[model samples]
Target chain A: GAGVSQSPRYKVAKRGQDVALRCDPISGHVSLFWYQQALGQGPEFLTYFQNEAQLDKSGLPSDRFFAERPEGSVSTLKIQRTQQEDSAVYLCASSLALWERVYEQYFGPGTRLTVT
Target chain B: AQSVSQHNHHVILSEAASLELGCNYSYGGTVNLFWYVQYPGQHLQLLLKYFSGDPLVKGIKGFEAEFIKSKFSFNLRKPSVQWSDTAEYFCAVNAHYGGSQGNLIFGKGTKLSVKP
Candidate 1:
């Protein structure tokens, strides 16, 4: 089975520009998650979706970030007015279901966003 | 606030040597612990997870982690590491009952360099 896939492996955005990263979860995954990993640091939670219903977004840094999983399989994380601080790898993960099983997420090759 | 700590920023070891990476979290309640590894040019992959019952959890590639409630730690260990084990290791945790269920708190990753 194909693992999770992300578009635009690397993106260089100018400060103040808007950027959208896309993720394609596994065929039947019901839970999706987004995370941001800064250089030399761990990945921080961004948001999560359970079959098109966003369950959590508290990890989002600010209002500049928005995410959607309309169809429950594909997800997008959009950043408005990108800042140098927003430069990091955006990771997407998915699991078969929620609860303890959700911890066994399969990750995609992250999209590295570099804000200039 | 919940947080994860990885004691080592970088470690260099020769092939076949024993390995141990320390990880600790600051959450009092029941939680799910995990170890993730990211090889160069690859996405983050789940090493193992500790949810309930036995504290010792074995993962892919001969990796294991022990969850200690008293110590609030889930340290990863490998008896005999190979050169292929060189990578970045991340420890993560999420609340079990309340709080954020699907969102994980990750530690600053530990970079392991193995010499063949």
Candidate 2:
């Protein structure tokens, strides 16, 4: 079975530009998550979605970052006015359920975003 | 706010050497713990998790972790490591919020370099 996958393995954006990163979660998965990983650091949670409903967006750093998962499928993280500090790897993960006693997230290869 | 801590930022060991990585979380509530590994140029994969039942849990590739509630720790250990074990390891915790599992809070990660 195909695992979670992200598109545009690498992306370079100029400061103040807008960029979008896409994620395709595993088929039948009901939960999706986004994370940001800086170089030499761990991934920080960005947002979470259950089916087509956005459950958590508290992890998003600022108003410039926004995400949506319409139709209960593919998701996209869009950053408006990219900043140099936004240079990091954007990771996407998915799980089979939302309220399982234990949720094991399957991660994608991640899209490395560079803002210059 | 809950946070995870990985004591070792980097570790170097020869093949067949024993390995142990320390992880501690700051949340006092019931939490689900996880360990993830990311090989070079690869996505993160689950190594093990501790939800309940046992304190010591075994995972893939002969990996195991011990969850100590009193100590707030979930440390990963391997009896003998191989060259292929070289990768970055992450410790994460998701606290149960409002009777539902929440997003994971990750540590800074530990980079292991195993020499054959």
Candidate 3:
């Protein structure tokens, strides 16, 4: 794909249900990131991957939030026991590691997750 | 831990109006600064970035931001804003010295509404 791609552009889940959001980063890109943007707020850093390794999960809000990139490519962010506060748009981005500094991070259309 | 602040929550302007959005980061070491914009129903896109070399950097859509190290500020600007430029803007920073690397800390974001 020419840019990062996310599946299920929108999802409506009942409270306490588990949901998984998928992100397919650009081919050959070595870095992938996930962010959560609440209504009328900026995107908050959720996790980062420098390949298959989940190098940074420091930003994940709580145990209910989990992310993984098992093959250094496609990644999934799973939220367990979704609450009303969990409603937000989930974004995915990919970048080349060597071009990390000045290069712009490409973003996906974002999956808007609504927990009812 | 790295944190970012964007003082302005919302602003409204007409076409050709000048724009100035404030952004500040709290970190004691080298840092990378960035501004991202999210249009209505669109994905987040990078507006500009300050990695190194010059303290002042220009970005897309006639936007620019200057990094003031002493003040720990990276303010975004544009000489003229169009109605199409109405969007939410975010300021982000990553600790350059942190070994964890690549993950960014973002501000709450400012919503700019440009009236025709």
Q: Which has the greatest lDDT?
A: 2
Best candidate according to TM-score: 2
Error of 1 at A76 (Å): 1.0
Over B60-83, each residue of candidate 2 has an lDDT whose tens digit, in order, gives 999999999999999999999999
Badly placed stretches (over 4 Å) of model 2 are none
Candidate 3 lDDT, tens digit per residue, B24-85?
Answer: 88997878888988898888888888889899999987899999999999999999999999
Tell me the TM-score of each prediction against the true structure. Answer: 0.96, 0.98, 0.93
Candidate 1: where are CA atoms >4 Å away? Answer: A99-101
Ranking by DockQ: 2, 1, 3
Cα deviation in Å at residue B29, candidate 2? Answer: 1.3
Report per-candidate TM-score of chain A alone. 0.96, 0.97, 0.94
Clashing pairs in 3: none
Which of 1 and 2 is ahead in lDDT?
2
Per-candidate fnat, comma-separated:
0.78, 0.84, 0.62
**Minimal lDDT window, size 10, model 2 chain B:** B94-103
Candidate 3 TM-score, true structure as reference? 0.93
Candidate 2: pairs in clash: none
Query: Per-residue CA lDDT of candidate 1, range A1-116, in tens?
Result: 89999989999999999999999999898889999999999988899999999998988999999999998889999999999999999999998866455557889999999999
Q: What lDDT, from 0 to 1, does candidate 3 have?
A: 0.88
